[model samples]
Target chain A: MFRAYSALIRKEFIQVSRDRNMLRLIFLMPVVQLLVLGYAVNLDVKKISLDVYDFNRSQTSRELVDAMKAGDYFIPGEEGQTKERRPLWHLADRFQDGSAQMAVIIPEDFSERLTRGENVTIGLMADGTDANSARIGLGYTAQIVDRYAWKHTGLSPPIGIRSAFLYNPETESVYYMVPGIVATLLTMVTIMLTSMAIVREREMGTLEQLMVTPISGFVLLMGKITTFAILGLLEMVIALAVGVLWFGIPFVGSPLLLLALAVLFLISTLGMGMFFSTITSSQQQAMFLAFFSTIFAMLTSGFFTPISNMPQWMQYITYLNPMRYFMTIMRGILMKGAGIADLAPDIIALAVYGSVIFSLSVIRFKKRTE
Target chain B: MNDKIVVQVENLTKRFGTFTAVNNVSLSVRQGEIFGFLGANGAGKTTVIRMLCGLLLPSSGMGKVAGYDILTQPERIKRAIGYMSQKFSLYPDMTGRENLYFYGAAYGLGRKLIGERVMALSERLSLREFLDRPSKGLPIGWRQRLALAVSTLHHPKILFLDEPTGGVDPAFRRTFWSTLYDLAEEGATIFVTTHYMDEAEYCRRISIMHQGQIIELGTPHELVKKHRAANLEDMFVDLIRKRESDNA
Candidate 1:
């Protein structure tokens, strides 16, 4: 059985090597995607265009406007060009025209109230279309205003919240997204490669020839999975190297443990590929099936948003998604330096999902031969 | 001649839902004989071959290949036979030599033996010049011959060929048949299905199947004589017409 399996794997390698362009693309894709998508997914809002309308033109209002522009988060928009100030209502039009993401208006008595030691309010408006950036930008603007008040009055607020970020203190999106990219890239490459390999054989009728051989279905499945599993691991290594070397994402945990979890993750992916091949009669069907399922898996895997934020039913559905657990394991190990003990539940979930899916696909593949 | 029966089928039947693709077919093939199966398209020749090769399960009845029950021990039967489908079923992306090595190893042949057989078979089939090229780049005739070489690399006791010369030129078809004769002479039973009536003449015995039934079975000469036809082609036509007229 092992002899036959090795022969099948060798044949796969020879066939893949013959397609020189494919060989190059497989290795190059992960690195390119990691760099390009890592920068693209950044959530740290910066250089937001700000439109300011100061009706008072007081020293305190000018001071407030200067304070907002002091940091990188907010920059003055076209409002700086006009000598005549626009009314507060026109701020809405400026936002609608994409001129600014935020607008700040100081009332006519804003400095008088500050000088008389009475409470005063500044009006702030923001476009709420993109909820994430809008919320973060609002928080930054409020913080800047509060700091300005403290500087002018020489009094701190009653409540001081000094929040510190843990794990990723700088809040670099790449630190979070690189690991997810590694997981997503591995899933794409492994599933697509394995399914295409099997479907190509079926389309060419070589699978029918193989069915007549002494090689059992279990042996054939093992041959295919093992070959693609190795390729998947190599892909992970390439992506991880880019994450660490190029993107500067930290890899603080045990490399051996990460590889073991990766193997388990790849078992699930390769199993899904095998299962797809069993149901699809042609390469085209296999490709569509693999592609749609990969996209679905990525969406529900908590790679982009928190699983807790999803609806209860969606959260339950994610329990069956192997990628969710893989994403957790990857983030835990890579970002937090988590050990096996810290990731026991995730590891168990992955092992269960991997074994069940792998075994089911093997059974289906055997049945398909008949 | 060896008296050992390599394949024996009794009342074998296969049904897809309500349609009976192969129904109550019974035949026996002896070692060292080229037994031809003749039928028109959709006549269930491929279905029977698939069942006998252990690639399909018989819906009912009993069959044995190489002394193993087809129902109980398909893996064992698979080990004992070689099969080449009507379609050339070798990997097109790999070279012919690579395909030979892969199949030989798939049958559990050792490295040294596979190497030796690859060399010998490539020489026998005159495939050495095309061995390094991908199978897809080879001419159709060469691809078919290479497929034959790959299927026979492990030298199984029985071989199943399903219309192996479907589109070959007459000269190439003759060469292919001569190779089968050589294999038969070496004590291998060859079970083949073809639409070509002239190819049926090369078989030691021929079976004609129609609409899921084997309506006629005999030596080519005997079948021609019994039907009072000018040739095997006429005998085939006469047999089908007789079945149709009987139904009418």
Candidate 2:
């Protein structure tokens, strides 16, 4: 059995190495995707245009505008880039033309309210077209206003927020995105390759030849999926190396634990690939199914959007997606250095899902071959 | 070769949906005999070979290959026979040597044993020159030789060649036939399917199938005389034509 398994893996590697396109796709795809998506999938909203409308023209209001400009998150809008004295009513137009993402209006009594020790109001309008930036811009606005009020009034708030972000202090989106991409790349490569493995043989009619041999269905499946599983792990390593070396993303957890869980993750994906192979006779069909499922898994996995932000029903549906648990596990391990105890639920869920999917696919594959 | 039977099937039948592919087919092939399975396209020739090779299950039938039941002992049957499919089934991206070694190991042969077999088969089949290059770019004749070597690598007693020389030139086909003769001489039972009637004439016995049933079974000269046809091709055409007319 070992001899047959080893030979099958060696043959797969030879075939993979011989095909230049597959070689490039296998080794280069993750690196290229990491470079592109690590930089492009940035959710960190910066350079938000804040059009300041100071009705008071007071020193306090000017200081407030300057405070908003202290960080890279906000850039004060020029007086009138498009038109001179752009009307405040044209706020909608400014947002429509993509000139300003947010506008702040300070009331006339802004300084008087502070001297009198009374509460003052400032109006901040944000374009909700890009909801993520809009929401973040609003949050920055609240922080700046609260600080300004406390500084000017000489009276501190009864309760102050000294919250510090855990795992990621500056909340760099790349730090979060790199690990997610690693998980996604592993899933994509393994599922696509394994899904195509058996189907390609069947399409080329090599499967019929293999079936006539003394090799059992179990050996064939093990040999094929083992090759892909190793390939998937190699892709993960490449993505991780790029993540840690190029992106300088810190790996906070036990590397051994991450590697162990990655194997667990591969079981589910490889099983899914095998299931697809049994159902589809053609490689193209298997590839389409794999692609569609990967996309579905990615979308629901909270890789792009947080599952909590999804509709309640969609959030419930995400529980069925193994990638969702893997995603959380990846981010937890890589960012927070989370141990298994902290990740027991997710790890347990993955184990259950992996075994069930792997066994089901294996059973179906054996039946199909027999 | 002794007179022991290697392949025997009785009332062999396979059905897909409502169509009966192999309709109660029955035939037996003896050790060292060259058995020709002849039919037009879609006459269920490939289906029958698929069943015999254990690639597909017979919907209803009883058969044995090398003393192993096709139904109850398919794994043993697989171990005891060799199958070269009609399609060039070896991995195209792999070199001929790699293909041979892979199949050799798949049959549980060790590394030294596979290497020895590869060396011997490459020499025997004149495949040494093309053994190092990928099989995809090799000429069809060379690829067929490589596939034949792979099928025979484990040295099974029974070999099933499905149109083993389908698109080969006459010279290559002659050489291929000589190889078959050598295998038969070495006590390997050959069950072959072919489109070329000349190749059919080379068979020790032939079964002519039409519409999923064997209408004639005998040696080439006996079949030609029994059907009163000029040659095997003419006899094959007359039999298929008569069957079509009867159906009409």
Candidate 3:
């Protein structure tokens, strides 16, 4: 039984190894995505774009302009010579195309009003596409503008405020992002590989051939799982090496714990994929369905947003996500230095998910000659 | 030959909801007998074969295969019999030798036995060079022969093949039928389902199913004489036409 199952898995791995392009994809694509999405396409935005239309050519207005240009919050654009400076503000189409993010507008008669000890209001507009960048751009500009207004007008609106993020600090989006990437990527690899492998057998007629043999469902499942679990471990090793060495991310968590958790996770994904392959009559349907499902799983699996942010019904729905627990464990270990005690719940949930999916797949496996 | 009734089906009935697949069909296949199951496209021959192999459950009645009850000891029955479906299916990505080893090991054969049989089966199928080639690359005839050899690796007391020779060349079909006869001579009962009436000429006894019931059962010669037809196919059409006329 062991040998039979091992043979099946080894056969699958060998087939995968034979395809050179897929081999490259399995190892290379992750690093490429990380590099591009990490440095270039980023969440933690820095330099903000602010456009100014200074109508009052007085020292006060000039001082206000210098102050706006003082810190990293603002990079002043060409004060496009025009009336009302709304046209200058309208020159913000470049920013909409990702050139600039935030713009600030100062009103006319600025010196007379300030000298008379009257308050002046400045207008600020922002591109709010990326909520994270929008927040940064909005916060920094609000602080700078408020300080200038208070010194000149002697007016303070009294409202105390405090804001905090629960999990990660320094707001390093990479720290939050890498853990989710690990879960999403692992799911894509394991399920696609196993489902494609089994579906290929059915297409090529190997499954019906194997069914005639004395290879029981239990033996077949174990063999396939163990073999692919090793491949999944290798994938983890490659991903971690890139994360640590190339991207300068930390391996603060236990590598052993990560791999062990990953094995259980791989089992669940592969088993679910197997069940999927059996239900589907054609290879194309199986592949497309697997793709559709894993994408949905990643989208809703707490990868991009906090579970608390979602409504309770969606939160309840996510309890079924294997990657939800995996993402929690990965982030906890890598970022929070969390141990088994901190992750006992995740591990148990993953174990239960794996066992149930595996048992159900085995029970549902129809060995009919038809 | 082995003093064991290798397969027994008594009043075994399987129904797909209201559509009965096999209706109270009782049959016994003794050791070393080649039993042919014949039917048109929708007949229950394949369903009966599946139930006998323990791949499907009998809706009602009792059956025993290889000294193991079909209902209670299905896993044991599964362990004791070899089966090959109509597709001549083998994993295309793996080589011929790999396919044999996979099946042999699945039956709990040790590495030594698996390795020896892999070589022996390749030689028997004249698949020496093709042993290294992926099964998908080989011609269909070789695949059929290879599938037959793999199913017989563990040498189960009974072998069930569903239309194993459907589309092969005449020469290859001859070899496949000869292989079945050889297995029977070696004390293995062969239960085969086929549409090729010429293939039916080789079986010692044949059961013809129309709709859900085995309407005719006897040796090929007996069936030919009883229906007053020249061959099995005409006999099939004759019997079905009569059944259709009677039903009308």
Candidate 4:
């Protein structure tokens, strides 16, 4: 068994090495995706372009503008250029041309109201095209305005809520996105390589030739999947390294624990790949099927969006997606420094998915080959 | 070169859904004999070879190859036989030597034994010039030779060749036949399927299958004389036409 398995693995490695396109895809895919998702898919909602219309032009109004600029949340002016104030009537033009995302208008009597201890309402308008950034920008504006009012008016609010964000206190979206990208990269590489490799053999008619030899189906499957598993782990390591070295994302958890769970995650992905190979007759068909499944797996896995934000019914359906548990496990371990006990439920779910899907796919593949 | 019965099958049947591919076929081949299976396209020749090689399970059959049951001892049967599929099935991206080593290892040959066999077969088949190049870049005849070398690396007691010379030129076909003769001379039973009448004439005995049933089986000379035909091709066409009309 060992001899046959080794020979099969050696043959696969030779083929993969010779195929230039496959080699390019294997190494280049993770790096490109890491750079794209790390830089472009950011959701931290920083550096909003704020257009301030200071109608009063008072000392207090200037102080309010300074307070708004204090945090990294807002940048005053148009596209961070030309700090000289533009006419207030041009606000509509600015929002339409996409130069400014938000504008704040202070009432002319803003200082008189504060001196008399009377309430005043400042007008705030936002371009709501990107609802996420718009909503977050508005919330930040409210907090800044309230803090400025409390400081100047000498009136403290009755109740206050102090909330601290753990894991990612600075709220750098790259830290969250890098781990999700790692999970997705592993899934895509393993599923595409395993299914396509097997289907390629079937296309060349070598699968029948192999079956006619003395090698058992078990040996053939292990040889193929084991190679792909190693490749998937290699891709994950590359992605994680980019996350650490390039993105400077912290790895607070145990590296050994992460590696162990990653192997467990591979069982399901490789099984899914084998299952696709059985159902597909050609490399293109296998590729399309694998792609379709990964898209669903990614969306439902909460890699881009949180599962809690999905519809309640859709949330229940996510229970069937193995990547969902893996996504949580990745984030939990890498970001929160979670241990095995802290991630037991997710780990248990992932283990169940891996074993059940793997056994089923193996059985199906054997039956198909026979 | 002996009279030992190396292949024996009785009422072997295979069905895909309701379509019967090999129906109630029975045949036996002796040790070291070049047994020919002649049939047109979709005539169930490949189906029977696949069944005997244990790549497909017969719907119902009692068959044995090299004294191992095809149904119960498929792995042993696989070890005892070398099968060359009709399609050119070697890995195109891999060198011929790599393909040979892979299949050799698949047949459970040790690395040392595989190296020895590969060396011997390369010399015998004159494959030294093509072993280092990828199989895809080799000419068709050279690729076919490489495939044959791969199958025979383990030196099985029986070898099955399905349409071994389907699309090759006549000169390459002659060379392929000579290689087969060499193997038969080395005490290996050969089961080969082809539609070429000239190739069938080279066999000691041949069976003509039509629509999942063997319509005629005998020595080529005997069959041609018994049917009063000029050659094997004429006799095969007559048998097929007769069978089609009978069904009609």
Provide the lowest-lDDT 10-residue window in model 1 chain A: A157-166
Q: Which RMSD values do the candidates have, in order?
A: 9.9, 9.7, 10.1, 10.1
DockQ of 1: 0.58
lDDT by residue for model 3 (B40-101), tens: 88888888887887777888989889898988777788778888887656777678887777
Per-residue lDDT of candidate 3, residues A37-139 (tens digit): 5565444455565566676667887787788789865676656434534575364465534355555556676678767766556555554333355567657
- Greater-DockQ candidate between 1 and 2: 2
Off by over 4 Å in 2: A44-163, A367-370
Superposed model 3: Cα runs more than 4 Å off:
A19-25, A39-172, A199-205, A275-280, A366-370, B1-4
| Candidate with maximal DockQ | 2
Instruction: Compute the interface RMSD for candidate 3.
Output: 2.8
lDDT of 4 by residue, A237-260 (tens): 988998999988888899999999
Local accuracy of candidate 2 as per-residue lDDT tens digits, A208-305 = 88889888888899999888998899989989999999988878899999999999989999999998998998988998998898898998987877
Question: What lDDT would each prediction earn against the true structure?
Answer: 0.84, 0.84, 0.75, 0.84
TM-score of each: 0.83, 0.84, 0.78, 0.83
TM-score of chain B of each: 0.98, 0.98, 0.95, 0.98
Please write out the lDDT profile of model 1 over residues A1-370, one tens digit for every residue.
7889999999888887888866875798898888898887645667677777777787888888899899888878855325876656676566544467677767788889888767777766665433334557668877987788788887653212232233454556777788888999888888888888899887888998998888888889888888888888998999998889887888888899999999989988998898888888888998898888888888898776556446789989998788988998898788768788878888899888888888888878762234
Show the colliding residue pairs in model 2. Answer: none
| Cα-based lDDT at residue A312, candidate 1 | 88
